[model samples]
Target: MKTLTIRRPDDWHLHLRDGAVLEGVIADTSRHFARAIIMPNLVPPVVTAQDAVAYRDRILTALPQGDRFQPLMTLYLTEGTDPDDVAAAKESGLITAVKLYPAGATTNSHGGVRDIDKAMPVLERMAEIGLPLCVHGEVTTPEVDIFDREAVFIETVLDPLRNRLPELKVTMEHVTTKDGVDYIMGSSGNLAGTITTHHLIINRNAILVGGIRPHYYCLPVAKRENHRLALRAAAASGDKRFFLGTDSAPHVDPLKECGCGCAGIYTSPNTMSCLAHVFEEENALDKLEAFTSLNGPAWYGMAPNEETMTLVRQEQPVSYPSKRDTGAGAITVFDPMFPLHWQVVE
Candidate 1:
């Protein structure tokens, strides 16, 4: 067996839905990741310091025994979010970042910020406090073609925001387009991007090529082959600005199979195996540690975990974890569509 070991990876972006779904999926993430930035787009949304504390408690309760996982909490940025509360959360280390989801952008995102002007109070405070903003990075305007949303948002929303507040650390989460890659690569400071495990492996084809595979559909939806190539190169290039954020969102199978399917792809179960395969294809397996482990910690201003994870390349392909059972429902696992050869050794 060919074995590769590196510092344990962290998920810069992840969604652990509350209650039963949270209980069922927490182990898949905690088993491998030392830490993850838990998204705040809950049903009612985590909007206050008190809410963060309660949510953190629930996450801790859901964590599987013997798993050493830290849930880095975040507050959801809304038109009415309190700036003083945001500053205090950062001061107390109760929250790691603030998430900005444009209203109607994705699942449970209806409460997101619709007017940037209304959110300036919290945002300006984040800039002063040095708390990062993790953005969904897509505009929800009806006229913008779904495929063009990411680029359009960059030209209109993201760039302007960055220019206005250069000190506000920003994490462009689940970046799916070449425009996002180039923009981040060209940034001089206070900017970084998290490339998701699924985005690196699939393109728009996976969603529409063969009669609508809803499981493959996600917000900031996958783009063209050229864009996928850009993401792959950036992730494997060992650039500190690009790192792993699984955005490993899980939705029930029933919800995904319907006409109005939800947007998400659960990847925490086998992200490392999928990543190893991609890095090996690029002939940059040595750089996997940088993308998966090192760069993310550096961007968030935290030290890399002392613990390590190992992947062994087996002669046979790794078994597919087609679906994970959460008490709420059966959540389908993301299928890379190619055989995974690297198995994470316990």
Candidate 2:
């Protein structure tokens, strides 16, 4: 078996829903990642420091026994989010970042900010306090084509915002288009992007080629092949500006399989294996540590994990459960559409 060892990685962006779903899914992440920036888009949304603390408590309580995982809490950015409360949460070391979800952009995001002007106070506070703002990075205007939203967001939203507040550190979460990649690369270091495992592996074609593949559908939905290639290059390029964020948003099987299904790809269970395969295929396995472990912490202004994990690539393909059982319902696992040979030998 071929083996690779590196500092244990942390998912820069993740979503573990509340209650039974959170309990059922937290282990998949805690098993492999040392820490994760938990998404805050819930039913009512985590809008305050108090809400963040409570959510963090639930996440910690739900973690499997003996697991050494940490959940870096985030407050969902809404028009009414309090600036002083956000600064306090960051100062307390409980809130790692604040997430910006454009209103009605994705699942459970109705409470997201509809006007940047209304959110300026909170954004200014975060920038002054050196807290990062993690953005969902898509516009919700009905006229903008879904596939073109990311690029349009750069022109009409992200660029203007950055110009207004260059000191603010921003993470463009789960970027899917080359336009997004190029924009991040050309921008100042204060701006960085997270490339999800699914975005790097599948293109829009995966969702439409052989009938409608709901499991492959995700928000900022997968782009064209060229965009996928761009994402892979960015991930493997050893650029500190880019890192791993699975955006492993999970939905119950029923919710994902019906008419007008939810948008997300559940990838926590086998993200490392899939990532290993991608890096190896790109001949950049040597740089995988930077993409998976080092860069994220560097961008977030934290140290990399002291812990280490080893991955073994055996001749036999790795096997993963087709679906994960949750009290809410059965949730599907991401299938990379190719055999994975690397398994975390924890």
Q: Estimate each model's TM-score.
A: 0.99, 0.99
Candidate 2 backbone collisions, by pair: none
Q: What C-alpha lDDT values do all the predictions have? A: 0.93, 0.94
State residue 232's C-alpha deviation in candidate 2, in Å.
0.3
User: Over all chains combined, what TM-score does candidate 1 have?
Assistant: 0.99
Candidate closest to the true structure, highest lDDT: 2
For candidate 1, the per-residue lDDT at 75 reads: 96
Q: What shift in Å separates residue 66 of candidate 2 from its native position after superposition?
A: 0.4
Name the regions of candidate 2 deviating beyond 4 angstroms: none
Where is model 1 poorest over a 10-residue stretch in terms of lDDT?
A: 1-10
For 1-346, candidate 1 gives per-residue lDDT tens digits of 2899999999999999999999999999999999999999998999999999999999999988878999999999999998998998899999999999999999999999899989988888899889999998999899999999999999999999999989889999989898999999899999999999999999999999969999999988989999999999999999999999999999999999998999999999999999999999999999999998999999999999999999999999999679999899999999998899999996
Evaluated against the true structure, the overall lDDT of model 2 is 0.94
* RMSD score of candidate 2 (Å): 0.8
